[model samples]
Target chain A: MKPIEARTERGRRAPPLPSPGVRFGEGFLDRLGRLALRVRSRRERREGGGEARLLGGGMEFVGFRPYRPGEDLRRLDWNLFARHRRPFVRVSRRESSERWSVLLDRSASMGTGFPGKLQLAAEVVLGLKAAANIEGAEVDLHLMVRGEPHRHRGRGAALAEWMELLESTEARGRGGLARLLAEPGRFKDARALFLVGDLADLQPADIPRLTRSGRDILLVQVLAPEERDPTRLPEATHGDAVRWADPESTGVRTVRLDAHALAEYERGLGARLEAWRAIAAHHRVSFTTVTSDTPFEAVVERVFAR
Target chain B: MSVPQVAAALALGIEWSRPSGLLLLGPAALLLLLARRSARPVERVTATFDLWEDAMRRIPPAPRTRRLPPLPVVFAAVAITCAALALAGPRIVGSDPPRVFTILCDRSPSTSLPLQPGRTRFEVALEACLSELARRAGSTDRVRWRSQDRETLELPVGVKPPASWFARPAAFLPEIEWEREDRPGFLWVTDRVPTPSPSHALVFASGGRGVPGPVASRGGERVVWREGGLRVEPAPGRVVELRGVEAGRLGPLARLLTIWARERGFELRGGQERERALLIEAGRGAGETRELRIAGGSLGWGLAGTGGAGGIAELPEGAQVWRFGEASGGEAPILVAGSPGRVLLAFDGVRSVEGDPALFALAWSRFLDRWVLPAPGVVPLDERRDAGAASWDEWSEDRFEEVPRVGAGRGETTSADLLAPALAGIGVLFATLAILLSGGGISWLRGRLPASRTRT
Candidate 1:
């Protein structure tokens, strides 16, 4: 694989790399390895690319087949022809690998969680990048923020560079998952698309745009535990009254915390999740909910296993 | 109202003292308005609000709160109410230190009438008078008990009267020239109305089957006739001749007789008196006979109609009996007369009279004035002539109403300072509760409460 090339823009520069000897935690790497093995096994089973197989002989002379009209002359086995006095062709099996596109949402809402949804999403992206590296597959990293994509490519040290970029990244503005998916130029030959976002502000119709590309689409919904069950949130449970402000719009509302209000909130959340699920199903997308508190490796294993 | 005036009004039992304090309500309302205009600090949150916003839209907006929270406003209201009340000086008036009371009790013969089975008119009058004194007397108030006939006697606080006090007969005549400045209040308890005076007087009329006839007066004196007796004005003086009677036999009655004579300007002669003088003679013996001429008729004592001592006796024809003795079947007459100028008095218990000398003196005094002496210059006033027939309104006015002159004395006004502490306490309690409710105490308490099941 080619080393990832740095792309620079007029007013934006790539994030600086971390110093040498800096590495992800060993425990995180071990979990990532386990998750990578599972993904590779699954991929191999589905695509039949786990081992080498012989076809028509090549320079290694693994096997031969009788020559047919209009066959390539370069692939003809001359030794077999001279010995057997018959035309033959050589063949060889080629190793196949998948390309994965990891899309991370860096919206303002993602920055709201305790461990931060953006941090969790970055961890998940790192896990996927590590898996692809082990599998000798091509990987692309995209940070979707404010309807613009910041892209990086490669593995190993490139993975470290991506990690450093994500570490220095601050979540702000709006995510453009739907916009990025609609732009074919952004992910033109990618085999699989892994999106990590809260998807909180996205419309239900926005998710189906990913299906237009006919690529393997995985929708990983990264959410804070408080977002998943707001009634358990301190603000909602500890006081008789609370004021909720929107991070994106800066709009505000005050509400009384009561059993009825909590019930309504839970119902609304359930409905939202259900609507997302339905949208995902209609678009043939794999959808999963991951909380910021969930281990990144566990998220990767669950989301990429099947 | 002026502060002192408001305080005074409060002291006098007026409601809503310091009405001007209501102006504070306007400021309180303004404070509330400013609070409402002030915005609550916003809470910065990051979760997607689309669903919550939608849900909120589905429901109605919560009722707008005061710029201040409910708890704080409630507390403020409580504090204001308390402060207003305190400034207003809300109080219950009239619980002042006791006042001095001088009570004059009537112990006339008519007061002995049994108005109820067990209670005499005098007993009823005494109770009513003492209750009045008690009502006016504070812990430190001094009370003096005076009989119409006797000198005033200071009574210890809360002391109960002996039953004999009510039974004792009139010991002295009412003092018409007494001054009012000697005591804060002067109460007269009697069966007949006395002359109204410039001095503040509380007259409690007791006894008799019906209300006494309106009082009638001539000159400075007044009189009323009721209770089966002639209640005269200015009891007249009389000269009495004691014939054939030894002073030693009269016991304590001798001294009382002399005092009565001195009070009435009467002389007690040692021998038979001249014409128109009262004659007192003990029966010479069980057999001694005495002739009495009255009202153009003549009767012989110890004769057929006038039996011996302790026997039923009848007055001669045309003779009027003024008063009766206690003996059953009318054995003796307390006072008898032939005409307005002629009268005779006799009694069998001179030895026993010493036991209650004042009572006996009063009885003899009344007998002398009614039977022997000419009526005093002050004539009896008839109720029908002076005040007309009694009406219920007038009766109630006469019995129950008291018109006090403004600023007369502390006796008419009450102090209300006792209510200050209580009103202040109530205000403070409300303020404390408001503080707790408004100052995050509610949330703290909610935290302490069992978690609601619906809260995830």
Candidate 2:
């Protein structure tokens, strides 16, 4: 198999690319507690999933409400009705199977840079698993690899094993995001969909098709620092020349690593970003660049905050 | 024999030497505004070879928000900067006597060799010097040099006499009279390296007539009439052997020859081995009385009319008579001819010349000195070469620094206008920048300038 990254090259102050088990800071799991999830999707994912409460009949009491003329008489509280001589209804929160389908791209391009995006993808998946455990939501992880998708489907109890599965997942495939999302039943009826990838080959026209109507779609653009701006790393000594080999294909680019080229690259990148933004906006899909260098918990927060 | 010389140089700041330079910034700003540079577009000019030049020039300037091309910006910036500096005078504060350079005209024997047809080595070097130095002031930059005839010309460079002022037909000697005064430094402008290496002070050069070129051209004998007496000398480095004449009778003739030989570094070869030896046999005066005469190449070196002569010795056929003197019996041959194909001379024993032996000996030796020696610059005698001759290789190189120059400290610090030199340098740089930014350099590179609807 080809190497996942160019080399173990990084700036002096930058942290080493996280390995399969790079230790996180103390209270990393506790920090996960700070995250809150609010799903706007009213669709039911499955029979036992924590779906939105369109009609509630579970035993857990959540609140009381004034009775409406069309309200079912079974839900009215007799005690409250006698005291105030007013009709009152008992409201309880519903417990349903609300599944979150996260399509984490494992394309070869994501694996090809300093502090490779593959590492960030692993961290993002671990984060979603933890957040799902807290919200009592089921996670259906679709690792977008070549051939068959590597599926890790579960709720709270299986989350630890799911984290291990994500950590072990390598960026060893090339799945053009547009092609994968076009497949029928891509997410298996999940309430919300989170798409994570560097999106090297993704087209703006594919945004609407990838985002389901009435579904919460958060598309996270995982970029290594060098990818966002080639001039940021220590290796970017301008006026020097570098020959780049494309990881997704056999194509290569010979560039003068100078200020002018860097500027032009940045301009093109901005245009690419705007393209993603405009299309994502039209589709009601939230899109953002999630860099690898950021703290994992903060990265997780950014992913959900959208 | 030699002295060490002057020194080596290599700054910046806000001290405005020419404050008026600030006015330049306005004009510079205006020019930049009118002809502002723009970033080069990163597109290939698809126009064919013919239209490529036009297309290149027609590349529209970058947007105002973008950066300008560094080359034109740098040049324009520097040009404006220099124009400012030029307007603002800058001066360094310093003071000291300007240097005194003594150009040692190499009168060394080797200089006599003809480097080009009709021009000796010394003559060529002298003519080369006709183009004056950088033309500094006489007071500030002094020059001291001696003509080939030994007349010293000392004056500042600008005020010094022109090339014509150097006396023509200068003579060469085996050695030059070095200055004994202990000046701190001086520059040695000689083809021959008189010194060993850069480590020590240079010294007198070796005696070898290095690289025996074409057989030496005869630099005729020189004789001058002085106030008190007549001074006579031969073409330098001539060797002659005397026979049958006693030194006691000849007065100082013997001593003079010894001195000339030592001075010119001439090798005194044995008479039998000599190729151009003069044979002079004393002849008996015994014939009828006859009037005498003197003539030929002998008159070329101060010899004049002869007195009436009588019975002397007769010369054989093919023997050329040099001079005739009055004798009791017949005319005596003062200087007679030598063997076939040779110009040797010997006085046949009847030696009283001008009725005074001493005067005749003196004049004759000086006269014979020319013919006696092989040509003046013939193959230089091998014996004169010493270990010091190795330095000849040093001269083959252009490393003149190895030979010491006149040593003089830069004078005491005074307020020398530093602004002047800075402005001068900036002016040069600005010229270069102008050429570059104005597309003159590009025209040269492209082989042809982009036509502005311009005809070839």
- Best lDDT among the predictions, by candidate number: 1
- As a whole number from 0 to 100, the lDDT of residue A28 in candidate 2 is 54
Docking class of 2: incorrect
Q: What is the DockQ of each candidate?
A: 0.14, 0.06
Cα distance off (Å), candidate 2, residue A170: 9.4
- lDDT (10s digit) by residue, model 2, range B244-360: 444333334345444544444443333533333333332222343233333223333222321223323455433445544333455445544432223332322222233344554
Score every model by TM-score.
0.38, 0.37
> In terms of TM-score, which candidate is strongest?
1
- Candidate 1's residue-wise lDDT over B256-347, tens digit each? 55666566556766775442244555432233233221121122112111212432143433344644333346444433333233333343
What's chain A's TM-score in each predicted model?
0.69, 0.70
Taking all chains together, the TM-score of candidate 1 against the true structure is: 0.38
Candidate 1 C-alpha lDDT tens digits along A116-171: 77778888888877766755557888776445776776534476577677777777
Interface RMSD of each: 16.5, 17.2
